[model samples]
Target chain A: MDALRITHVEGTALPMRGEDVDTDRIMPARFLRAVTFEGLEQHVFEDERSGSVAGDRAKEQHPFDNPQYAGASILLVNRNFGCGSSREHAPQGLRRWGIRAVVGESFSEIFFGNSVMIGLPCVTVSPDELHELMERVEERPSAVLRIDLTAGTCEIDGFTCAIGLPAAARDALVTGAWDTTGLLLARYEEVNAVAATLPYVAGF
Target chain B: MGKTLLQKVWDAHAVRILPTGQTQLFIGLHLIHEVTTPQAFDALRARGWKVSRPDRTFGTVDHIVPTRERNRPFLDLLAEDMITALEKNCHDFGIRLAGLGDDRQGIVHVIGPELGLTQPGMTIACGDSHTSTHGAFGAVAFGIGTSQVRDVLASQCLAIEPLKVRRIKVDGVLPRGVYAKDVILAIIQKLGVGGGVGYAYEYAGSAIDRMSMDERMTICNMSIEGGARVGYVNPDQTTFDYLKGRPFAPEGEAFERAKAWWASMASDADARYDDEVVIRAEELTPLVTWGVNPGQSIGVGGRIPSVDASLPDQQAVADALAYMGLEGGKPIAGMRVDVAFIGSCTNSRLSDLREAARIVKGRHVAPHVKGLVVPGSVAVKRAAEREGLDEIFRTAGFEWRDAGCSMCLGMNPDKLVGDQVCATSSNRNFKGRQGSPTGRTLLMSPAMVAAAAVAGEVVDVRELSAEVAAGAI
Candidate 1:
């Protein structure tokens, strides 16, 4: 994979309000049965939005199902958004569902790491700022929300709030340095040299 | 101040600090299963990358393998394709695979410890979240994404941020009926679901010290549910004794040297911690999930929590109640169950089966409920059969089947039908986690699940244990 840089994303916002929206809810386990994540877009939040399995026909109230947030490219969520299962499909499903970036109060450690590798940067803002951003987006669904990684800020119609990203994540997103696989390949000699001395590896 | 066990293990594995400011840590062992590795291997092939350390990696088919049938060409075409893909990928990459027919084949977590592949003072990685299950051996094991799986395959290292260590001590003796599963459930319930974020939990104290190797594994397996990316128990005599004489463990003089090194990996008496919490083990009871999340649990005979703003997060509680189709403030013991499942990485070991069999013998499943028992691994299955545990289950009207992760997360054919409420021994009680989007899962211990299977409703396992002891069955 080539180094991919993500300096900024400007798109409409899909607002979701909940704490600890785990990965299992993000992409249900049944969808994980597929060979690949190709058709995951239709299944993102399948249980929350569709109620297809239960046939409740109530049209579960959720932001993703709202026509106003139809093509939104950025997702705005509350604290601990991806809290369960370490499956990469949580982010993959979101990315497949047209989510290019996530702005939240906090994210689970594994979810954040998975997003970073896929070039989807997850930024954090204060509760006050998040409330303001959500209100602004909900008021005008079509308003352009800008998330600039280089500037560490989110802007909506001249209203800007400081966003926080780890310095390392920011540097990697800006300089297209997130491809750790290439770095590992370049250090092949070092890895083998280290592996040779380990008893477990030798036993194998 | 002395460093904790987590720091000592992490520092030993740290290769260097990369330009991105992430630590380039070497992974000593890489475990893979059929469900997560296909995409990873494809990505590696797309990049024309060869596995840098195939010798250190092991493969198995667990998640999608049917627990009821041992025949090939699975009834589920998609599951069959996944198995074939994993087999081809392992062969092409020179990775050793413990396929269905292999004696070693089983859940990735169970086979690792039984084969003695899991050791102290090592870094382990796998595509499955239960990789934390391996941390019970004192290694820092992490569950990686498919992309990271590709990363490990090509480089045998992962770029990660260092985590703070929180020491959790559970002092005093455990009650007679409370097992390791109950201990972990109680801890997660008290700490909330997201309490351990950005921290590695170091389990200790008298309770953890007295636990057997299998019991320790059950505690560590669900660390992910508590929001901790990794959880570990410091290696000691118990850990060493469990690994000794196993298939992959060091032998003879080498074993002595290995034991000495492993003993040195425990946290020092004066080790510092980023945070600390203590609980008295005697105060714990057999706990079960009352709602969607693992943290939304109460004691077996306790009432379901009333969802309101006064709770930790009222919105979450309300949402959980709504998803679970349950009313608040009701007794949890009388909830009806349509199915009962016992088996998963969490509580599918020999000891777990033995305890469940003891409760189930001379009893029969409730007419309204369907009961199934899937062992963790082939070895566990054979061991259970030799002890007539399978016969006990079958005679009690429980379906005795092959070994795999059955009814756990609904990855295979073993799944709950729509709207079915299942009493389960597996971890995670999330809505629709048992296959059907509307299916309900109540997480409990194996003994509790067995009791529910016969009662057709949630009942206190202790009550059943007492009856079994008095020959009431």
Candidate 2:
């Protein structure tokens, strides 16, 4: 089977400035009523984008609403992005909303895992470097940024910085092994063998 | 060197090192709920894959189940459709489901332990982030996304990277008013919300050892809140005792054998951890989150942190303050609470209910405050009602509700209306966490929520304890 290798991602950037932005904010709990994740992109940051006070319909000043960053496929964020709730919907919504890659100072482990599983690469840079990237994105929302998973670097406007993706994650992305179900299913016998050895599974 | 429980459990479950350098670790148990399973089931059908270990997988309807009403064709049609989808998926896959109207039905985390399905030396995967709650049994449990859920269903395994283990030791006895909720909140405050990323937390020391199984569950439940996907306690006599006669636990001689295996899975005395953090239980006060995230908390007696422009987290602090509509430097104690809630996988067990009821026995909820007490599970609700704890809460003017994740994430009908400030016993104070986009949450222990319910504001639970002792009420 041919694997889909994602060696590099290049796109216009959208900068959302916040620290510890939780999944609940990305996709509120009410939107989770659906049986499928379809149409979740429309509700990404639904509450944050629309002010909730007194049923106000005025759109909040959010980067997702900024016309300059319209159609941007790269998300630039600050420290601890996607920090709460293990909802894969957070990344799914972001991906559906056209965020192909995310570059932040840090990411919640589950969010990182979920993003990688869906073929969306989440890479990290130093806080200082991330601030610079956010500034660069804000200065020119149309600036194209490129994330090289194999090279482990992010470059924008002739400026380059080291990006951090765990070696395992990077290898998986570059090899298109991120959707791990097929890979895991191939080792079915091995899985049963391991389970059989456990006292709990083997009934002591 | 000796091995930590994480290493031992991981090594035991590991099938092989994949070509991508991730481990193919077998999952012994896979728990599913309404919200995250339908898409996974669809993916499985798309691939024409059968559940590899249907016996090991269990399903429950919780997230979108309404707490107040439980009739066919739910008031929320979307919720009914989601639960119906889960039922159909579970039925098609031959997975056991504790759906609505089943006594076993409850929050997945609560029902798992209550039924003894969560055991030590196992790898538990659930579609919910709070799956870490199962780690209280010494299991290597963590939350997985829908794709990983699909992987587990197809292969009973996950391709994942290993994590470093951090030993968090909290010594000494907890103060009178402090509880496991406070201990975890204190730990999150000491360690930033993102501090535990890429690591598993091994909760040790005398304080953790002294906690009951429920308290330990409360501690492990919020590991995800601290960016740690897994947190656990070492199995001991307490763990064994809790599992002794549990419905799913082994019987007679088999139970003894399982105990031996479970005890052996505890971290060796000389085990090496990647990191260690030591905290004193005496220093901790009943903590309350004053900001949006769990880490932005302080002692009830302490003031909300004032934002300093020079600090790197200044923006975060400022934003939280702005969103919470509170001034920094103000005491967290007397903040007006429009709602008081006690329930979630975090603290809706029998003990949590009993403790909250203790404070609500003779006290009436403040007229202006909307008080709610939701039990975590049907079993918990039954147990609390058997003990007449529900009567105490109802008499105190708090709405005693059925079991579900009500008002916790607010996927159900129980939710805050607007910008109401709620003193909640559940975890997570993120923006719109309790249903209303503008609703604000102040997370604390159940007793503290009860105190706030009566006082119409946040008050130190210790003060209320003292009042009870003094016969002031």
> Which has the greatest DockQ?
2
Best by lDDT: 2
List model 2 lDDT by residue over B298-388, tens digit each.
9899998888887776878887888898998998988999999999999999999999888888999999999998898999999998999
lDDT of 1 at B264: 81
- Candidate 2: which docking quality band? medium
**Candidate 1 RMSD to the real structure:** 1.6
The docking category that best describes candidate 1 is medium
**Which 10-residue window of candidate 2 chain B scores lowest in summed lDDT?**
B310-319
Name the DockQ score for candidate 1: 0.64
Expressed between 0 and 1, the share of native interface contacts present in candidate 1 is 0.62
Residue runs of model 1 more than 4 Å from their true location after superposition: A1-3, A51-60, A196-199
Candidate 2 residue-wise lDDT, A109-183, digit = tens: 889999999999999999889888888888888899999888789999888999999988988888888888888
Off by over 4 Å in 2: A1-3, A50-60, B471-473
Model 2 has a DockQ score of 0.80
Which pairs clash (backbone N, Cα, C closer than 3 Å) in model 1? none
Deviation (Å) of B428 in candidate 2? 0.3
